[model samples]
Target: MAVTDVTYTRHSAEAAAGLMDELCTVYADAYGQVAGEDTTVKADAFRDRATGALSARNYELVTARADGELVGFVFGYSLRQERDWFAGLDPAPEAGFTDERGGERTVVLAEIEVRKAWQGQGVGRSLHDTFLGGRLEERATLSANPDATATHALYEGWGWQRVGTKPGRPGAYYREYAVFVRRLPLLDRR
Candidate 1:
């Protein structure tokens, strides 16, 4: 598809509240039918997940618009000590792989997607770059659905490499997902 026009908006977690419905629509439109779940269930889950991430420390949200209509968004937050999100990572990582204080050194790319109709035109990439480009984290990580090979390839193409695969937890909606990590460029803050 021809990508002739696009724009991006960066929002702090609290400020992004007004766009929740639109964000929900885009997320549902992209992921609603996954793993035997229906649109309503997936949409509801997205809402809950977004709500949780909104309260995270240093949370960030970025939305992409193509020709003035919402197409996609990317958002994440610094992983904190209390969460210890990486403690059980399979293969155990190489060593010293995460924030010592729980979440300070890493940013988690919690959710990102381009609407179904907007997938092939690089909207997702645009959202990703613009969202993470300014991050202060030393490392970034995400878990992609293993069944979605295209997403695996997309992450690889964007400089992320597979770190390990995470088995599905009991009763979790997620499938077995491939965990990937990337070292983000350290920007001078001084």
Candidate 2:
């Protein structure tokens, strides 16, 4: 369905906390239980992760609402020089590629979720562009499930390049993801 009434809003971490319930609802709906994976449990994990990272430096949450209903959102944070976001990267990227100095080199795209009903109508791409377009970092990075072919294609189409692979978290057992990166100042692709 084409939604021409969508409105995009950028929220600070503090403001995002107030919309946690709404954000999680969209996330849960976007990723309904698959292979016995309960979305409630997954949503809780997402809540914990998102909550903890909300205070990270330069955190931003961009939300999309259609006719007053939340439909999608994207959130990310700048990477600190003292931390290595690609610590577990397999076949590490070329030397200096992953280096972060003064938290300006890279922005880690933590999550992007769109309601199932809003999947096609340009919501995901719009959210992605809006989020990255506002970043001041040199580049942005995100990891996609290796099995999500369509999602990967969407990112690639939006000018992201797969740099390498990163192993999933300890107990997830979902294998690895293709880490993608895109230079900053994204072109007006909308």
TM-score of each: 0.90, 0.91
For candidate 1, list the clashing residue pairs, or say none. 79-103, 80-102, 80-103, 81-102, 81-103
Model 1 whole-model lDDT (C-alpha atoms): 0.82
List, residue by residue over 123-188, the lDDT tens digit for candidate 1. 888888988897988888888777788879989999998888777665557756788988899998
**Cα deviation of 185, candidate 1, in Å:** 0.7
Candidate 2 overall lDDT versus native = 0.86
Query: What's the true lDDT of residue 143 in model 1?
Result: 84
What tens digits encode model 2's per-residue C-alpha lDDT throughout 5-25? 889999999999999999889
Q: Could you say which candidate leads in lDDT?
A: 2
Q: Number of clashes in model 2?
A: 0
